[model samples]
Target chain A: MNQQFKDYSQVVSQYIGNLPNDGGDWLVAQRSSAAERFTELGFPHAKLEAWKYTGIEGLLKQGFETLDKSPEFAEHAVLNQFLPEPVAGRLVFVDGVYQADLSTCDAVGITVGNLRSAMAASDRTVLEAIGSLSGVGDHGFAALNLATVHDGAVIRVAAKTSLEQPVELLHMATKSAEGQALRSRHLVMLETGASANLIERYVALDGVAYFNNLVCEISLAQGARLTHQRVQHESPKAYHLSDIHLGLQADARYHGINAAVGAAWSRTVIHNRFLDRGASCELDGIYLAGDGQLTDFHLDVDHAVPHCDSRESFKGILHGAGKAVFDGLIQVREQAQKSQAHLHNANLMLSRQAEIDTKPQLVILADDVQCSHGTTVGQLDPQAVFYLRSRGIDEQLARHLLCLGFASEVIDRFESETLRLQLTEVIRQQVRG
Target chain B: MLTIKNLTANVDSKEILRGVDLDVKAGEVHAIMGPNGSGKSTLAHILSGRDGYEVTGGEILYKGQDLLRLETEERAQQGIFLAMQYPVELPGVNNMTFLRESMNAIRRSRHEAEIDAVSFMKLVREKAASVKFDQKLLKRSVNAGFSGGEKKRNEILQMAMLEPYLAILDETDSGLDIDALRTVADGVNLLRSPERSMIVVTHYQRLLEYIEPDHVHVLAGGRIIRSGGKELALELEAKGYGWLLEEAAA
Candidate 1:
């Protein structure tokens, strides 16, 4: 069946009948227009310039549909390794539906809860963040998420507050969510003079075939700081797509890390814009793609104001028949003098069958701006391998060490010890395979 | 303890080492000094089991073992160390981690107890201090963005930790100033004993002034044409290699 033929009817119909009508008429009208946009845009294809290397034919052929109700899952015991311990706050979601019984919100200076409730009560933070930054205009995936998302995590920080511990959101899927489409919306708003750490991890059962589409919108007020960590470890047979939008005000700082390690096909698009001068965003990421996997990261940063700096460093380890694409673009506007933007993408192709495409572009329209981009897609340096082997390390272990070296620059940026250790083990296993 | 007889090697079908013969007894420092394009590094690399060189005709005997048959790590496990002319810069692997992993690997092959975190840290610190290397560099990526002198010091530090039976220093004095050369020479001299043998390959007589060599060999056109005592280095330095290259050609 053609993807256009199956259409977004099933998805729109399920959105109209989701849970309850507590989100008020505004949300209803917005969802209706987004549903129409979803129908018009449909699913992103290979012909699209943004998705030339990554084809969604296999995902669209899966024939996904929205779930009638939240699925029952009692496998919390086996998920301890995926969740870091002693976090300040933990919000658990299964198939995009908030599970309050399995969650705990104990952090100070924050009003954190389910997004559906925040939307129902017309929360001011949620109202400004949900669809404002990540609009449904050009991105079809974001539109689909805005039109069909049920329940997700919502975090609002009070001014002049800094949390001591990290806030975590664990999004997992079970067998019941297989063959279904799951959409989640995450909103994070930091008032002036506030700072917090956020971690959003996506996971599913082994070999589960599901579609996880998520949109995350983050807004930072003046002098606000945030550290965001996103880990996508979906099932080997699942399709995952995430759209992350970051808006920074004057003197606000943001640091983000994206670790993509699973899913048959996955893409994470991050959009960063400077709302005022003196803001800085440093984004770092690492990815591992093995046999029959396609992992991609696309980052777009706009330097519209002066005195803003944006830096992106991404690396990937691809083996077997895996394929990965990294596209990063940094644009400095004409009025944005003294803007500093630098992007780097490096990949280690560990196998003969692996493929990696890195495209880093910088467009500077202003004078006296520092802008540069560099990318490298290559196999492990044989000289470096020889250096390790000459030190008495075996060749296999040497290769694994070099591969791990490529990822350490990004992995070491995470503040969570548990998550860092977990990512280390994951990189080890991927190289060993 | 070390012997290379009629060692002939080729790289990319071009002969680099042509019928080179050398021998070093225990506790002896044999300096292989040669002009440019004389394949000084090839001999060191072949002995250390580096790949990419086709040893067309050569037989290396290390403690009476067929050295050419062993893999690179195997050769290293059996206590053969090569202080690379240009130490590789690994971008993200910590220097201390690399040292510890390498030490443990060699130890594991010898069926000895491995060094744990505490002991390894202590050992690396002492060794680094002895080599005049900064302890802070141990926490950084291995040799990444290091100065030339720092790289040479790192090589000596690795040599100190490994305690290899046969140490091949290939042009270890190429990029060091007088102070760094003296420090590195001191480190090399400290490692010298009745049981450890060393082959110091260099192109200058300055390093020979500090670490006195037992035997000096002048190699020209891929073959060693002159072999003499430490005085031979002074003679060659006084007079350029023009006469030696002519003699080798003749």
Candidate 2:
């Protein structure tokens, strides 16, 4: 018997039998099939080509026992530091269970609440959007998340509505359920001509050792614009796996910036598909790993229609025995004429033992497509260090400045000043350690 | 202001500077002319405390202190500057931020108060104008995507900002046109004073036309083959370096 798979299946089956089918039999069917899919796929191993550079053996061996019921927040003030000051329309989720008391939607025009409530109202939009992309049979972790998603976030913006303040979603893993796994599912849909700023953050309380599987599916209609920011800072003993699926229609624009600095081992996969003409997606990310940590970013941008454009830039800074991997793929179909895409991956390795594996793939099948990718891996430039030192900057400060500058190139693109400043400090702290 | 006695250096285990001797007084401008790979850059790098260059046998005295024993930043704090031939590009560090931090570091080392933002901006503007550096470029990354001329001008800007007591220009005019050369030369000349001395290391003589030197020395085969007054540069420019190589052999 595959012990790892059996452990997950047994826990999932027990949880499935306990779930209340209030949303009718459709939701129950979806949950059961998802569990079967995850069991068949099993945990990704090193043998999988896509997971070659990363191994989940240790994470699987941890034996993630499922929690019988959602754990309540332990009423700790520590959650304050993980959130932005003067919170604006923020949703707080602890152990994959949405906390309504801790969450508030300041904006009156936006519809932001928990998925469980929306399911009670028989919200077809919420139900259809939650597991819409999970039927494809890829992404075992995302399938697992769908199988056990008890409560997540549901955000819907009507046509021509604009939100002044960004909506922040905080997912925290508390120490109460140290050995359990938490699954989170989020659905974000914006109608035509709608605009909003969204922030999805993941954090784990100190010393929490759990598995967090999150799936966020987003759809932007024609002429819609969404700026999404994701910040992941899990505890050193926790495991995090996130999948983001974004679908953009004609004239829709999506800008995403992901900053990941915490977690013992984490991987974030972002898949953006442009389904209509004149759509554009811009994605930028920064990942820092120190000591024994491992961080990975896998971005795939697919252009199925013509006149679509995408730009991707992800940077990794590794110190000590840390390891990082960045794989960026831009695929343009044969019918995607006039499709333009650019991808760049740069890594800075501070320690000799640190390793970075970067792969930038650009496949253009159209005749008039413009696609290019560039990857660079190196330590700080000696010439630059000497230049700084020759001007009286100390050796240590000089190195810090260089690394900060490298990481800031991505953070500087953030549109929100509050997030930008906060993330700058976060990056500074990471670089300091 | 600076003295080099039987200074020898090697690069990557290969001896580059066999034995060189030089002396410069305050308020003096000495030019070192040499062929390619004759240790002009190696000498400058060694004085600036660059790594990987072994000082096989050398003694450099700067203001009566042993210069080689100090670290690169320590040497800079002591007022020794080397304007690199190829200025390094820091892609995300703002030029103004780099200049301000560098100036403050040196000032702090000298036990002086750090310059305030207003004063620093004012001072930078004044110095930038001297080099004809655009105010807009100050907001950009240090030397990133800058033209060769802009990079050379940036080096001169740093030199003017630091105000080194003994400045070493390592082929500063290599990639500049006549217009850029004049701008750089003017910036260097503006910094020349009675309390300061300069060593102009160049492969060509065009830079000397703009910033005339008090003394000129011809270096060939890692040794000073000849030394003369200011007119030496003109003669060397007229005759190729081969003539000096033959003269050194003879």
Candidate 3:
């Protein structure tokens, strides 16, 4: 039984047939076209320029099929760590299906609920926003997510409202989905003058091999602001892929951070586009890959309007035989004058067998723009290590301190104190591992 | 407390410290002054057991133990502290953390209990105050973004905190104004005790004016050619090192 030869087209059709028709003909047509696009494009491969460094052969060989029904999970308590004490909202999903009994939505100035339920009432705004951005660039993974996603979060913040707490979405997988595929889709919209903080975390209850594809579409109206943080701590045997798309209007701001501490092979692609003028954004990320794991972060920022600014900083600490890849591209169009954009990628190879491939690409067509990009891949500074050792710190402890210090610059940028401290512990464990 | 006999060392396959000899007793301060390329700093590094300097000849004895046989940390644990000529900046390790860890390392080697955080904080603050060092900077990264004078002052602070038996200050007055030099000298002067010895390595006699060394030696060609009392420093300051280098060669 060859895994790669199994037919996946039937699974796509079956997923589409199982979806309710309450969304009218428009959603049906959108899903049909998305399935067609996925079938045509298929899974991304290393031959593709955008994914030249990462190989998806292992993912394709898993022979994944959409999990039509939620499977039984005995470890319902696995979502405890992700559920902070004083959160504005919490949504727990297992295998692309919302677990209603385990979720709570008590936030003010916001409407948070299951995506499928929100879409069933023919919410034209929800459908239009989801359909417009899901498969915009013909990305195969995004198309698959749009075509097969069954349940996720639908959050809308009202205008001129500010939330004091963060909304968290916990996406977990159980061992029952060993050979199945999970696709989750999220739509977050912020109206004019609205502000909120959103956190999305991924975890796995068991160390089983599965394919998880996620797609999130975000829209920020004029004068809106959103702080988004994404954490991926999947099982070491899991294959994870996420596509995040963000659209910013005039004077809108988006501060995003994507961090990954555990995964066999995980990739997060973030695409941010400035649709109006005076929009600014800060995109920063950190990845700690150990024990032969692989992590990648791909970012693309488009400055289509004038007076927009974008800053990106990414760092990776790779130990064991782990490997990491970072590719960031900031593009400034002809009319986007005074666009200040800087992109940087730094990697600390903690072991001799660890590897990293990083590139910071800048494409500026405007003459009055300030754009720069740089990449650094090196081991910890030997001089700094010796400095600590000379102070009587052992060589191993010195190395650990240097590695942690190297990672602190990126970790300290998170505004949320709780998340920052949690990620600090995660980084410490990775360094010591 | 310290003795080096015909100590020959090489750096990068080139002979740097060739047949150097020096001796210092307890409670005494020895000042080794020399021109450039005279291996003044090399001797300091050799005593502190820094890597990349191969000691090809001779031996160093501290308290009847072979100092060259120990590792850098081991030498540090045995109460040999080297205040670097150019201190390395560590961007992530906090100053107080480094100080506490160093102190614990020394204590652990001596089979003593490690100090707790509260007591360690008190100790560091006291030592920092004695050196006139700003305690607020201790919360920042170790010597990161510190000025030259501040780095020198930090070295003195470490000396005060550790209270080593043999303290070697290598060019601690370099790149410092008169005021900063006085502060650093005062810090070093306060650390002097009957049970401790110090080696002041410098290029000029200005620092000696404040610390008042007991013995002075002119180092030329990796060897101490002239050894005398504290008056030798005044003579060398008046005549400069040109005559000493020529006389040593002759």
Candidate 4:
């Protein structure tokens, strides 16, 4: 192996060894295996098709300082700005480590605990699916996250339980020093016949250069329904890489919405696998990038079994000199016959300097499947702008209103009113700025 | 209240309006009757400052100011309103929100205190009822999923709310039934005042029976070929534009 690969493997091994092994033997073993695979494949380059748009050379060259714990920082007002009233549970993490004293989980039938506590409690069900949905070490960051998986939340919804209130997971990053690197791992599982809503927010507290590596896996059993939402609003000095892997069983329903607004350089990967028939999934995403921000989304929907349906739509607005990349793929395996899937991606470039790259792909092996993919990139309709302006709305307000209307198609899909409004404000700020 | 002097405009380098001149005083409704492709819509679009239309020559004056120099919204705030022939659908922006924003914008430019939400809702509901629009339409996106008639009624409802000094109804009667056209005309008539002027542009004379104009002009080949009192619209409907075209050529 090369010297760089050797150094990376050593760091992974050392991090794993330092983890407390109290009843977390299985998790440790999984991490070690994942680490071995990661060591074998250090970092992906331009050669890899999936990593073509996102280059990891900057992350590798800087050699981030490992951040096992968070430093003391003032409470961010934006943190509590849009928190839903009377949430069933709320967990706050700073730089991957949980701050239990500031957390609350008062709702019945829903338990929100730190991953460390759950691991030490030896929850076999949680351990079995820790890194299972993301699969074994296909991506370099997934492997690296599994290796240094120090702290995050373990959200459990009991069987036959239905949560009236949403559960919030806030992952915050505060720089103790420049070049700090934080890694977080979250495992959430919904038992049979359980239904719940989960909102995860990642915000940067400091504007110092840092790297945030996060991985979350979700598993839903038969008749389980989950609404998962992720919002990334990091500082302009931060680099974020997040992965979400979901698994659905028979009759399971999953809805996911991802909003990427912050971070100097960010990439989000969402991989969803439907394991059985009668599974339904709805995925929606919106990314509003302005100024010098670089936002990228790579999503994949795999239909492994027959008689499933999935719908995916993503919209992006690039302003100023910002750049955005979207690569969405819907794959229907041969055995997944009678599957129906549709994928659409649209982008609005406000300034000529703004750039967007979109690729929508569909690989259907089953002749009985119905699948379609489309992408559109253009500026705001001048006719629409003029129409609004003629109604006595100023040019700036007219443009803002037009852009809001453009993004509202996706924002209106949210069932939660509070989250929808919060997202609207975020979108407005991004567009106006 | 409004004056157009030898105005010429082009869209995409193709001339649509060729030296058109007309004038309308307060308390008078001037109807411009023209065949399709006769620069009828282009005139309305240019008056509203829609992009892609280059005003090659001439000028428009509103209340003695250079109207062509003002921005679309600025002209709108100065009491100019254009009821689009085809209203653009805005999905996700609620009717109430759009109206409030427009009302506030005009009010702000006029240095008037903004209306609160309660007052705004009351005004909107009242105007909505005056135009016979369903209250449920206010909850939906602006003109989204609305039928053709409903979209026109929505525009009239907006006119009632904004209460502009000069309202330009651009083919507002095109897709409406008899009842809908009556409601729209009634709404426009109710807002008519000595200080408010109107320009009703339509190709058909059937709408004239509902919203009677004081003066009617025949716009053929990008110019007003003839001008007369309200009876002129009826004469055009009876004789058709072919005779008017022959007269203009002569």
Candidate 5:
């Protein structure tokens, strides 16, 4: 009885029971095994070492119910705010269902479609890459996402092909998802010498008090390059969790940026693994946590090959009673010599109640490896504010400018010019108060 | 343009400016020379509306308005500029954006139409060239990794851009080399006109050689002890503040 401690695992089992019998038989078997894994893992609690700083007790208390049948959604004009038209490729998923009518996918040198279709068609790329890399089992969210995920975007680029325009996948939660759990999975595969850019955005259209669990797995072959950008603007009353796994082969380059500006309680986990030598990864992120918000970013970069480099920098602006956590690990194997990796997390607290729990670790087993991890938790500099104020900038606007300055370093690295300007303005509005 | 009626201030309960009195007319350049430990910087800071100083007594009048009532930025919008001895380094902040935002903030406060990017760029380039400021540096973070001389020159460049009516140079020559000093002085000289007044505070007379002041005052024990013309600075250079201290004591 003591071993059978009750948790959300039973609730998730009930969800798996009601899951629709769709997709290929292989997916049903995969879902069954994932459910088994979830039963074994249960749910993450503060007692676990990795869950020491972030506690999902609030998420558990939400009593989320998974969609029993296909969800119903009414497209609102507000969705247009997230969907900027004229995109090269666009996929919109609402309430765990992909809307083909709302998507304009140009599958010229690539395969871009939703998971259910890819799974029904027995696409080998999607079948092999879905849950292959998120194996650390650090948390139960990945397994839950796998057990119930019905729909998401799948992108596969052929060798020697470079995408001229970026592909965007927007996941929106609608009224039917309110007080319910939504699961989605994405798989991106780049062949040798292939290059493409993708942007994944999670937004709350109408639903509040919903739970969004997502897993995105990206694999790149030799000499491949991919730029992946993620933005989370979930409703302030929603709980969001995501796992982004990256596997890079020889000479592959991966550039990723994660922007989190909403969600009452959110945690983003980024796992990077280098399969061969000469691969490099640059990951940057920024999160704005307002009062009553808890935003956490967890990262793990595994360097198993020589001559690989990785740089991870995440910044946060915490105001009012906001709290944040940044946990990053950079590990270099014994043979992974000449590997250079640096991880930095900087947070600015606007109020005394605002807090941050940051732990950056560098595990170097190779003698010749260059590895570093650092964290900086600071407040608005009074001297800097005085300097700006002396230059005729009011105190309020001075603080706002300084806050924007702290956030722009990462925001500027976002790939698209329009998105960069759009995100900057959004950040400006948030920091203005 | 400015008047100080026996202005006194304290820092942490210790008096730094003890009943200092000064008056400056439009177009006049007043050099406030003092030895170390005097309240030269204190007076400059008070006039610029910097915090951390308690106004123990006395008052300051700028254009007949109670200067103490205005905020730091308000004084700036009202045409008061202080070239700090140590300019605060703001990392991750684009210097060009900082300048333009500051310029527009002051302009908007003064009921002047805001300057657009194109015009601001043109004006800044012209002023930056006049000050010998590297245009490349303007694109970098504000004062981040700037050499000592570059920082001072950047300050003068900002002063030129803001076009302040009353400017205070607080130890502008402290860390400058000869060439840097000349460039800064030249920038300052270009901004000199009948509509503007300046207060140049320095410990050495090196800066005075290039930009001659109409009146020179020796500050000792937190108050102006002596006031004279440009020849007074030459006299002080010939014989350090020892003679002036003795004369003031006598």
Candidate 6:
């Protein structure tokens, strides 16, 4: 084998060697499957259309070491310091492994446990659905995550259960003296008529180089309502790759908000499939990039049935020498008549050196569907700046207010008040920095 | 209280206000009536310290200081307020927050205590009601989606809240209905005092009917062609600016 393939195999072997005996079979199978796919796909290059804007050349140059399970790392306060007080059914993960003892999962009529325990339990419904949703054929990191993910979290909501508070999933990565690679997989299923809000947060501890590969799959049954928020605030030395796949049944409502603020190199892929009629989905995102950071988002919303509606809006604020890319697609199948979809992507370039690439697309095979897409990239409005400055606001405060206003439209859509406020604070610190 | 001597300004290399000289003492109201492209708005913008206007000649003095040297915010802190012809809509910025920021900025410049939220809200509510503005407008974003009349009323409400020593109204009655015009004029009239001054710039003399300027000036081709008492506005309104331009050319 070549050096690259050898390195990949060594990482997989390290993760598989550490799996507990109780859940060794499932871990071995998943790791082998993922490794085989990784060997076939290898690292993504500019040749791949989805990875066109974000080439993984630098990530491949330095092969990252797999991180060991460290429950003691949960003692770090960076997660709770930035987040608000924990809501109900809160789960915390340290270095890719779930920390169930420190989490709370009461009053939701749902079960939340570590991925290993859930995989070994009598109910194998969660494991059966893993990798069942297609469309990962071209995504290299997603296939790699499926191949080697050992422990994350599994959450299942029974029928007709309505959660009073949002479930918080905190993923913390603490880098040791030697850099490490962390992979995790999360599964979430809401049965018929179940309603809940889920917030997944990722934070990197200390200032060391690391790589994180994460995959999250959510299944919403008939009449199920779910609001999912993903916040990425890792250290500047970290590289993060995440994929989110969602499937919605009839009359299901799904709302997802992503706030991407930190990391040196980060890429997020979001695939949402509306399988049944009358289902609605909305995705709102905000990304802030500055200095040497590179942030990329690839999103696809599939309307597989008739009368489904979807709206996608993502905004970016780029400063210094940072670069950002947004590729959003809305697809309506031939049989999906009467479908309605809208996609808008806007970016604010705060510095002359900063750059943004936005591509909004619509592909509809149905004759009776309404679809529209738009993209805008520009600097702050000088007239608005003068208007604010004329009112006695200084230049810095005026610019700050304009930037805050730019992000407030997306931030206001957050379902959790605490998360909203916390995200606002994060955006403020980022803009001020 | 304000003086402009030989002020020649250019916007984008095209001269707009050429050798314009004007003076207004305390306790006086001056109305400047001009035709289109006659630099009426340019003068208002220049007096308010807006950018993009190159003052190639002369200087403006306000309260014995060189006003031309100050930035827009500095002029604002010095109690100079301009009611824009078309108020820019600032989405996501609350009206109350904008007002409180302006008020406190001026207060800070004058070494006065800043107004807290309660006091500021109370002051805004009172001033907003005086302009007959709906309370809901205060909660909405600054001028976002406001009707023409509502936008003008919002400008007047801001004027009342700021209570500037020198207030310049730039076509404040352009798009208002009769009721809105009356409310806006009433709001302006209520704020007039012996220690304060105003320069009302408009294309027509209709607004002068309600506010009643003490002096009227006809500005043509970037200069004040004629200055007379309040009756000058009536004569100009009756005969139209075409006759005045003809007379000036003759």
Which regions of candidate 5 are displaced past 4 Å?
A1-11, A18-25, A68-79, A82-86, A135-138
Off by over 4 Å in 6: A17-25, A69-79, A82-86, A120-123, A134-138, A175-178, B111-113
- TM-score winner between candidates 3 and 4: 4
* DockQ preference between candidates 2 and 6, better one: 2
* Docking quality tier of model 5: high
lDDT of 5 by residue, B121-205 (tens): 9999999999999999999999999999999999999999999999999999988899999999999999999999999999998
Q: Write the per-residue lDDT of candidate 5 for residues A354-396, one digit (tens) a residue.
A: 8788899888899998888888998989999999999999998
Kindly report which residue pairs in candidate 1 clash with one another: none
Which prediction has the highest TM-score against the true structure? 5
Model 4 C-alpha lDDT per residue in residues B1-250, reported as the tens digit of each score: 9999999988889887888999999988999998999998888888888777899999999999998889999999999999988998986688888999999999999999999989988888888988899999999999989999899999999899999889999999998889888888888888889888999999999899988899998887778889999998889889988888988899
lDDT agreement with native, every candidate: 0.87, 0.86, 0.85, 0.85, 0.87, 0.84
lDDT of 3 by residue, B62-93 (tens): 99889988888888888889898899898877
- Model 2, B193: alpha-carbon shift in Å? 2.4
A354-420 in candidate 1: lDDT tens per residue?
9988788888899988888888888888899999999999998888788877889899998887778
Q: Clash totals for all models, in order?
A: 0, 0, 0, 0, 0, 1
lDDT of each residue in A264-329, candidate 4, tens digit only: 889998888998889999899889888878899998899989999999999999999998989998
Q: What does the lDDT come to for candidate 3?
A: 0.85
DockQ of candidates 1 onward, in order?
Answer: 0.73, 0.75, 0.63, 0.74, 0.83, 0.67
The local lDDT score (0 to 100) that residue A395 gets in candidate 1 is 91
Clashing pairs in 6: A34-A147
Docking outcome class, model 1 = medium
Local lDDT at B197 for model 3: 99
Model 1: fnat (fraction of native contacts):
0.69
Residue B119 Cα positional deviation in candidate 1, in Å, after optimal superposition: 0.9
Model 1 TM-score relative to the real fold: 0.94
Clashing pairs in 3: none
